[model samples]
Target chain A: MRRSERLVAMTDYFKENPYTHISLPFFVKWFGAAKSSISEDLDIIDAMFEQLGIGRLQTSAGAAGGVRYIPDYDMELSKEKIDEIIELLEDPQRILPGGYVYMSDLLGDLKQLRIIGKMFGAAFKAYDVDYVVTVATKGIPLAYAVADVLRVPVVIIRRDPKVTEGSTVSINYVSGSSRKIQTMVLSKRSIKENSNVILLDDFMKAGGTIHGMVSLMNEFNATVKGIGVLAEAEDDEEDRRVDDYISLLKFQEVNEREGRIQVARGNYFE
Target chain B: MRRSERLVAMTDYFKENPYTHISLPFFVKWFGAAKSSISEDLDIIDAMFEQLGIGRLQTSAGAAGGVRYIPDYDMELSKEKIDEIIELLEDPQRILPGGYVYMSDLLGDLKQLRIIGKMFGAAFKAYDVDYVVTVATKGIPLAYAVADVLRVPVVIIRRDPKVTEGSTVSINYVSGSSRKIQTMVLSKRSIKENSNVILLDDFMKAGGTIHGMVSLMNEFNATVKGIGVLAEAEDDEEDRRVDDYISLLKFQEVNEREGRIQVARGNYFE
Candidate 1:
């Protein structure tokens, strides 16, 4: 293949696989091109990704290293995205009964999820996340979004044991929103030992679920990379677990007459 | 900016907003180059996307013409990805209650979702899809994945209405698994009239919920662009409303006692 053709193929491959490493020799063999040619092609693709701040192309020297695409996001881009999310949350249309925001739309929105994922990914990118973790139901989207950008797998801890998962490792954690003792379980095989995990959820109140995830990680001999929430209530300041976390938007207050929302500062977006 | 820098910038711009249009004048102004030079740059980018089969750079000529990048995936790539998913599902550990395979891992897997998104995007590339639609719960991830690659907004129909979403338009449909009445709803403002929608979900049993989406789309005067499911069971030889659809795997049967999974031919590795 020609240099132009090879460049395109490499980018496409990286985008689909994310967080994967590729050696120059593989491309050199696939394209019947010189090592120098593949190197030059990567230079172009790497520069493109870096300038965009959406992904990173890292070149490893020596024998084992070739090129690894690190999926990431720009802080400015993240800020703009979160600002839009906060605006959406504050919309009178989103307010629902019992003070819950009808967030199913935001959760279902691909664009909004992408922004949230990127924000979460950006926050945890530096921490070496192996899996994006979330408890059953609503947290699935948040976990999936982060996993997509990070190019890592996601581990879902179910609210109840289903026969489909066979044997599982269960953890009893307090619910952040409901403040009830809930049991979350993972199929023992779903997670690998010594993996780095980033915990995420759609909404966070007391963060008891996140603490459960932390404990689950401990059970698996894994590491807790970071924590992220799509919406965090600022009023419940006493129950948070880790200070090192990011929230795309903060739900400041809710009343019969008015509600307040604001985007929090984070590493993903300036 | 230099040609090299301009090339990098344009590529990055396209990647961040994967499937969107950019006028020639936009590039011409950004690069301080002639229309012809911009055309050449675009050609290079298009060829790269084509060679990789991961993106499309389309050009329109006329008073209102410009270029748009539509990210896409090849059928062969989709097939390979499906095979991988089946392999994972085959792990015996995934078998859950009610013949539902534990899909939390696959749903949470970012790299897999990206491939799934790009492939689904390719299938609907020719369709005039406006918003992605799905019922609440499992459909959330499907909507998120499709929305990511299609660069379109997603509207989620709730199984149960919550206070946050305000007033909703409800639909009653049959569910695949139970063949029972299920309710799905959409906020009045969520989907626009005359919009073109693509329906997606993670699993298809009887495909009753999809029918509800179709009805809801009708209420909005919108068109059904396409329908897609991540996995479909073979025993569902029932009435079909979807004219075009794709699935990664076709489950032949699940023998719980033997801990065996039977999967038949799927388009993904074909």
Candidate 2:
């Protein structure tokens, strides 16, 4: 293959497998290029990535060393994206009965999910997260999106156990809204012992769901590294069970009868 | 930026946004390059993609015309991956009580999901699938994965209604296993009327769950374009409620008492 062709293929591979290593020899074998030539190509790729602010190539110079793509998300771009989404959410039509925002639209957009996922990944990227955990339904997509960006497994806590999953570990915790005891379960084989986990959800109220996730993580001897949500109920921050978390938007005063909704960019910037 | 640098960045953008169009002017503005220069860069990228079999860069030549990245996956790589995973599933340790195969590992692995998602996307990419639909719990991740590849939204069917999702359309279908009546639902706004959707899942038994999803889609006035499953039980194929679906792997038998498991690549290759 020619130099430009090899570069395109290499760029695709590196973008797909971020924070992962690819030795010079593997590139040499895959592209049938010389080590020195591959090194020069890497320089070109790294420079482009640096200019784009999409990611960076961390190259180590030794036999055991290789190049890694570390996603270097632009905070300004993220803020703009989040601001745009927040504006979309502020519409009165988005406010449903009982103060619920129509979150499915945001959850259902691929472009939005990519930005939200990367934003979450950027916030908790420093931690050693073995699993991105969330409950079933709405939170599953958010959890998977974060996992996609972080390149980790997503452990979903189902509301009810299914026969297909085999043995599981179940727990009961208070719902943030209802304050009623709710049971969530994870398969016994889903997570490994002593793993680091990051909890992500679509929305947070009193944070009882997140608290339950923390308890569920303990069942497998896992530690909670961080907590992040796409949106948080700004009204009940004082009543939340979990602190030290991140959110992209703060939803407050969502009164359907009044046709009123307040949406602001979350603490992701702060 | 130079043509070479633009080629690399364009490749990354195309890979990230598959089956989406990028107008020439957007590239022109983003790169601060001339229209002719951007055109030349796209040509180089398209040539490279054509040679690599990763995807194709389709160019349109009019005012509304632009370039699109259509991923043309290599089947040999996909077959090898499917065969390799089949070997892993054949491991006796993956077999669980009542002949249930432990699937969380595959569902959890980011790399595996990428391959599986891409594999499913390749099969249904030609279809005009507006939404990738799946029932809650295990199928959520798979649905999101395929949606990622196809650049579409995922509509999840919840077993029960949540106020957070707003108003929902519900349907009842008989569970293929227990033959018990069960209900599944989707939010009214998640999918539009007459949308084309593909039903995706982690596993298929009597096809009852997928059957439930098809019925749920009907309530939205949406059409079920196709159905794809990661694995299907061969023993119950004749007993399935739905026909005309694709599966990547076949679960023939799982005798936990004797610790014997049988697995084969599904109809995906054929």
Candidate 3:
């Protein structure tokens, strides 16, 4: 194949399989190109990727190593994405009854979800996340998005147990906002023992659900490497149950009567 | 940028934003390259994409015309993916106590989900789908996957209404397998009136959940253009409530006592 065609093919492969190690011989065989030619093509793609501020192709030495795509969205680009999200959130029409912001529409947008996932993936890129864990309903998409970028599996915690999950581990915790006890269940085979995980959620208020997730991770002996939320609402500091996490957007205020909403970049920017 | 670098960036763009039209001038301005150079670069990438059996870049002429990536996974490659899934599903170890197959692991796999999504996307590519819809929980990821490939937003129906959803439209439907009536809810704003949507689910037994979804879509006056499921199981033909849907895999049988499982490609292959 010519250099241009090889570049297109290689770029597609790297994008499709992020963080997966591909040996040099495999590429040479697949592309029917010389080792030197493949190496040059890698360098070109790598340079272009970095120049675009998405990420770079990390290459390793020796027989067992080749190259892998480490996807990263720089702070500047991530800021732009966050700003776009903030703009969407600031629309007064999104304000629901009882000061709740209607964000199902935003969460439903695949393009926006991909950006949010990439940003969270960038935030936790340094952590070796074995699985992206989230509670079902809304958080499922965010977890899958982050897993997509990190090339990891997503473990979803369900509100109720189902026959299809086989045996499961269940936990009950008080929801911070509602102060209601809720049960979260996960299949016994979902996560390996002592694995590292990143907890993600679509929204956070008083950190009840996130706190619950952290407690559930303890059951599997998994370490919570990081936590991320798409948006965090302001709550009493004394009511907060969890800390040491990242968020992309913050809800400073939402007044239903006034038809007003105030949103800003989350603490992750700080 | 040079043609080589342009190919890398353009390929990334098309992969990220499939089914979204982009004018040629937008590419020219974004790349700081001449119009002809951008056009030539698109041609190179399009040809390579087709040659790779992924999809092709479609272009239109005249005013308000542009190019878009129509992602299509051909039948041969799709069969290979289905076979891989079948190998995993056929493992007897996956049988649960009630003869249910454990598939959360496969569903959690992003690579597998992406492949499944692409296969479904290809199957419904000709349909002018406005939104990809699914019931919440397990099907959320699959819905997002299809939406990602189709470049459309996802609409998730919930089991119960939440405050964050604002006002909702709900319906009661009998679950075919369980023979119990269940409530399915969608936010009033989730889908616009008279929209076209595709229904996706992770698994189907008697198609109760999907049937419930179709009923909910009716409340929004949205048309169900297509239905796709990752897997379907053998059931009494008289008991099945849903037909005319596409599935990737079929659960021929699961014998708990014998620890045997049989899986085959879905009707989509036929």
Candidate 4:
């Protein structure tokens, strides 16, 4: 195959299997090219991805050695996307009663969330997380997206136990917003023993949900590698509780009187 | 950028934004190349993709003309993966008491599901689908995988209504396995009016859950472009009601006396 064609094929292969490794010999055999030629093609593809600030190609050496494509994003891309997302959320049309913002549109927008997933996946690309964990319903989308980019399975923890999942492990942590006792459960088989887990959610107020996720991970003998949220409330005066987390946008105080909303910077954009 | 680099960049760009179109000017600016040069680069990328059987590059002419990378799969690759999946599913260890299989492993394997999603997404890539629809909870992973490859949002339908999705449109349908009246609900805002949708699920016993999704789509003035299931029970002598659906494998029968199981060929491998 021609060099350009090889590069296109290689990139497509990597994109389809993010955070997965492909042996050099396998590619060499598939493309009917020399190992040297395959290596050169990968270098070109890797340079293109690095130049665009979107992905990375990591090479491992050994009997199981292979090239793995890691989906990543520039810090600026996160900032721009977060700004666009925050603007959409802060729109007056989205403001529902009781100072809540209607986020169904955002939730249903797979495009925006895909970008967020790629960004968040980039943040934890090196963590080697075994599973992506999230609470049911709203957090499912975010978890699914991150899992897609990271090539990891997502396990849903129900706020209440359903008959479908069989026996479950339950945890109770204080609700971040209401300070009430909120419970969550995971299927006993959903997580493996001694696994590394990444906690993800759609929103955070008092960081209680993440705390619960941390506790839940401990129960399963899994370690909490990282935490991520779509949005974090700005009133987190006691911000020392959150571990390593990246939020797309930090929620600013809502102006009920003037109907104004403010958002500045967050870890995702930086 | 050079022609080779432009091809790599374009492929990466399309992989990131599956269903969206990019204007000519956008690529021209990104590559710092003239419109004519960018046009040639796209043609090279398109032909390379077709040759590899990885995907297709669609181009349109005139004012809104641009390029789109429609996800596709090689037939041989599809067949190989399906065989592996069937072998895994057919293992006697997977057979649970009550005729149910322990599907958590298959559902939880991100690499396997990613390939499955691409194959399923390829089917509906020709159709203009805005969302992937399915009932919870096993169906969530299938719907999510399809949505990931198609780069579209997924709207989950629930068996019960009172859980957190707010106001919903409910429909009564017969679940094939249970043969009972079960209600499914879609969040009012989850789907837009007059949209095209793809229905997907992990397994189909009686096609009851898919019928529920079809009913929900009809209620929203939308259309069901395609239907797909990861596995189907062909020995299900009960009345089958679904049409135009694809399955990876069909369970023919379980010969408990002989310690054997039967599986039928599926169209996805073809």
State interface RMSD in Å for all models. 3.3, 1.4, 0.7, 2.6
Q: Give the distance in Å from residue A35's predicted Cα in candidate 1 to where it truly belongs.
A: 1.5
Ranking of candidates on lDDT, top first? 3, 2, 4, 1
- List native contact recovery per candidate, as a fraction of 1: 0.63, 0.78, 0.93, 0.55
Docking class of 3: high
Q: What is each model's TM-score for chain A?
A: 0.90, 0.97, 0.98, 0.92
Q: What is each candidate's DockQ, to 2 decimals?
A: 0.46, 0.75, 0.90, 0.50
Q: Which candidate is the best by TM-score?
A: 3
- Could you tell me how far off, in angstroms, the CA of residue A30 lies in candidate 3 after the best superposition? 1.2
Better of 2 and 3 by lDDT: 3
Across B134-215, the per-residue lDDT of candidate 4 in tens digits comes to: 8877777778778877888778787776433556799888887777888887778678788988888888877878877887
User: Which pairs clash in the backbone of model 3?
Assistant: none
Model 1 residue B13 CA deviation in Å: 2.7
Best by DockQ: 3
- Docking model 4 quality class: medium
- Where does candidate 2 stray beyond 4 Å? none
CA lDDT of every candidate: 0.74, 0.86, 0.90, 0.80
Interface RMSD (Å) of candidate 2: 1.4
Which rank order by DockQ, best down to worst?
3, 2, 4, 1
Q: Give the 10-residue window scoring lowest on summed lDDT in candidate 1 chain B.
A: B261-270
